[model samples]
Target: MVDADQTFVIVGGGLAGAKAAETLRAEGFRGRVILISDERDHPYERPPLSKGYLLGAADRDSALVHEAAWYAAHDIELHLGQTVDALDTAGRTVRLGDDGTLVHYDKLLLATGAEPRRLDVPGTGLAGVHHLRRFAHAERLKGVLAALGRDNGHLLIAGAGWIGLEVAAAGRHYGAEVTVVEPAPTPLHGVLGPELGNVFAELHREHGVRFQFGAKLTEIVGQDGLVLAARTEDGEEHPAHAVLAAIGAAPRTALAEAAGLELAPREQGGGIAVDASLRTSDPHVFAAGDVAAFPHPLFGVRLRVEHWANALNGGPAAARAMLGQEVVHDRVPYFFSDQYDLGMEYSGWAPPGAYDQVVIRGDAGKREFIAFWMKDGRVLAGMNVNVWDVTPAIQDLIRGGATVDPDALSDPRVPLDALVP
Candidate 1:
């Protein structure tokens, strides 16, 4: 029922953009589909970059979203190593960065994603300094870790966030000495709070990873264009053959900003502001993945999720919306992580101060427990550590928005489904 002359354009080459393109084709859209990416490689999932791939357990090809031949077979105009420099919202066109080629689009999806926040301290440009955001960064870090392992070198990590902690585990697995410098009192204090964050601290500490808590890296000392050590605010100098700045990532919103798109404020986890259907201020444009901040009907707050699950699911939702489907992107926020022997899956959003009292079910010492963040006797978020197959039940409890006794919630004997109204 659609015009074959119409075209749908996607601006990113990451998982979200790739999945959007796939969804457009799957939704029976026969119009011209143009997918542009700045990276030369095919779109790939990023979880393995810091997980299996960095640990040398998964191969590079395992990360690809689809086979190289799939794009051509599906008749997708795959433009790799291409950047969109200018977005002409008035003209419904985008200008290519390399050759200034202008491409028209009936509808545009902005999945520009995010970039790692660089460490601003001096000596960051020295050799052996690293930031793991892209495939190439992971490749280089893998080599650096291997060399450090063989040569007995030290690795100084700047933050205690997920990336820093995961890379710390990988470095230890490689037999390299690892030290993490964190500005918070405990690792992941912002996300898990100090209570649960201590669990991760102990996990890493058991594996020989040292933590310098409540300190920031003021300088990265180097000599002869190579890293030598990192000096923190506490005046402690840590010897380092390599340094990783795993502080965080900022959304890539330059293209959207230049196009006069509405952006969420800095406090709302800043990104391109989109509605429940992922439609931007301009009706002809939409957004998804890390670059899109949309209001969540469930959480009742505007959220910009940087996790893999958001990208994996948001892309297709935006695609369907673009194709005139009635879509509401209100899926509960979800993410997972693996470090050393501990693995965890978290659902819903319950940052510190948002919920009161965290109730734990099972034994924390054994690392097999489900922690629930509750407010007014209702579950706001749930994280199952070393627990299996209860994500559905946990999510149901959150979605049902029912209040239950804290004693029953903390009792393993009680079934999670029964708690949901």
Candidate 2:
């Protein structure tokens, strides 16, 4: 059933695409593997772009998925600085942007990934306004942070999402005055809800970061082609030397859309709609990472995850599925964030209105606690803040779908494993 004559062409050189290529070889496909990326740099992980790398605590090479020599050694055709301009689903071919070259493939994986959502406010093109989504963007922002720190300048950030907060911490680490503008009542309101979101707000406040909640940035005022201040809808103007638009990211679904693949609606976290095996509507085409919205059997929702863990695991899963292996990507959505002395890992999906109550264990004052979002006594999601080695147990409880007592869930003496059955 396996032959070297077959070729697999993976579009997008991010973690998902790169890992898929590696999995194909590891699975003993012995087929030609080609990976194409629009970015000039080799496939790299994105977490470091905002965390360690932004703070100058880690080097650029640490974020790379593989060494430069690894591709050639593994017989992977690495094509960097090239974009797939078109996808011809019927013909099983893709057109490269650099030239009118058409590459044919027996199977195709679209890991095109996502792009940073740009701010529609004026003065976005002004110098000192930045968005961190790529290695190059991080590289530029690193220098900007250093310069701002040296000058003791002010950094104004829009949106209090993960990127915004992480960069706020990084800016403070660089000794820059950091201020965040958010329309929500608290940080991460959409993800963690106001209850736990307040915890992050307090954490940042203690670290000398300013938060302007219940406000939206109306304009970015600039002078001499440089950011001078940011105006809020509340009629407040904050002096700013630099601005970061960390609102969020939008999936790159243009290629998949053009190919006539089924896509999930924008309201349901827009992405290429894929089955449990990560196969797109077109059987020969598959998708993974931030761009694929697959039905999560555990959560009972069509989920599209944009965190590092998704890309890290989604690629290999999609690869095995392409090889005709039974693959069900039902991994609980998971993500981690480190800001100042606080490190938190969140597992499962628990957006606001979805959970009845949030039960917390440990001390919120000490910033060490595990918060569980429950629906009718069933744990829908769990977030461990400054807690370690309990993710597996928390995931088990969620998968078990058993009613857990709030008192036991909140008791530190009770082992999380015991709550599963």
Candidate 3:
């Protein structure tokens, strides 16, 4: 149980940390809640950084978790631009950055999120080479994107993951020539599989975005410390006024590892390991957001979700666990993406090679479809593309452990509820 007098310290003032603070107040914990972030800005949502914010459709204030006054109004201490230098779990203290101020805590939540996986290739350190992770990165990339529009320049994007693809869309929207290079046979094939991945490939190709698949970037060539072009392993050169590396991210786990916290197995991507309740090896410490690798009850597998939904839901779940509530972070993993006119919502867990077959409802040619992944006739996961008002039904089918017929699942006329069991 939590004591009203004790202080609760939350590290990594991103969505997860901010939501944890909100949960504490909503759950009626009158303790001193202190949230810390290395970034100078207050906690903010990251989704917009790649879409609206980068395109000038939204502003920094629009992405913030709360306005500057909300923290004070809610009595939550906001520590921005300050890194937690050390975590002394036995001493129950966290050392602050530079100033070396030690903040004592009765309980701690490690919401330390992930950082972009750096590119080690040559010229990655160039001025025009960028990675999208923080608001600062977005701000710089936004300027380059605007410049690309004015100059009618080319933008070379490394990796065809969600961030890379989203940025490619934004770049094309700004009238820049966009070229995406992915090492896979099909973009996003590792996750969405080849069939669906080809859908995205077609979407981009229709919009005149070029693709270089089955090839890796050998070098990022630069002139005067600015990106000029990128060379592929096959020796093809692609011109670029700017380069964006969207390779993916690695969970920030130095603090947890240094403090002797257990980590998930190597096969699980090596994140801070936690139980269903989000508690770390030490009962006094907890982990959430992208940093946490917890056992997912639905699939009976460990997953480290890096999407916004996980952070939004995991925050409150971890908080309830901290308060001695019987909490299970068993929510079906969900994620959505918007690229050009295509918007998609996916629900449930489908570990690689886990689903035996896929059933498609709606027309893939029209870029409107719901693809269902099944195992032993039971729906394990589903994704709706350009489809509306069916997320709840899709989720129900997944959570209800219902066996759905392929013909019915592929037919739009059949009500999703009727397909249940």
Q: Which scores higher on lDDT, 1 or 2? A: 1
lDDT by residue for model 3 over 1-421, one digit each (tens)?
4677999999998999999999999999988999999999999999999989998899889999889999999999999999998999999999998799999998899999999998878888899889999999999999899899889999999999889999999999889999999999888776787768899999999998999999899899888898889999999999998999999899999999999989988688678999999999999999999999999877888999999999999998988888889999988889898999999998987755988898899999998999998899999999999999899999999998867789989999999988775
Cα lDDT, model 2, residue 269: 95
Which residue window of length 10 is worst by lDDT in model 3? 187-196
Error of 2 at 297 (Å): 0.9
Model 3 TM: 0.98
For every model shown, what is its TM-score relative to the native structure? 0.99, 0.99, 0.98
Estimate the overall C-alpha local distance difference test score of candidate 1. Answer: 0.95
Please give the RMSD to the true structure for each candidate, in Å.
0.7, 0.8, 1.0
Residue-pair clashes per candidate: 0, 0, 0
Q: What tens digits encode model 1's per-residue C-alpha lDDT throughout 142-243?
A: 999999999999999999999999999999999999999999999988889877999999999999999999999999999999999999987999999999
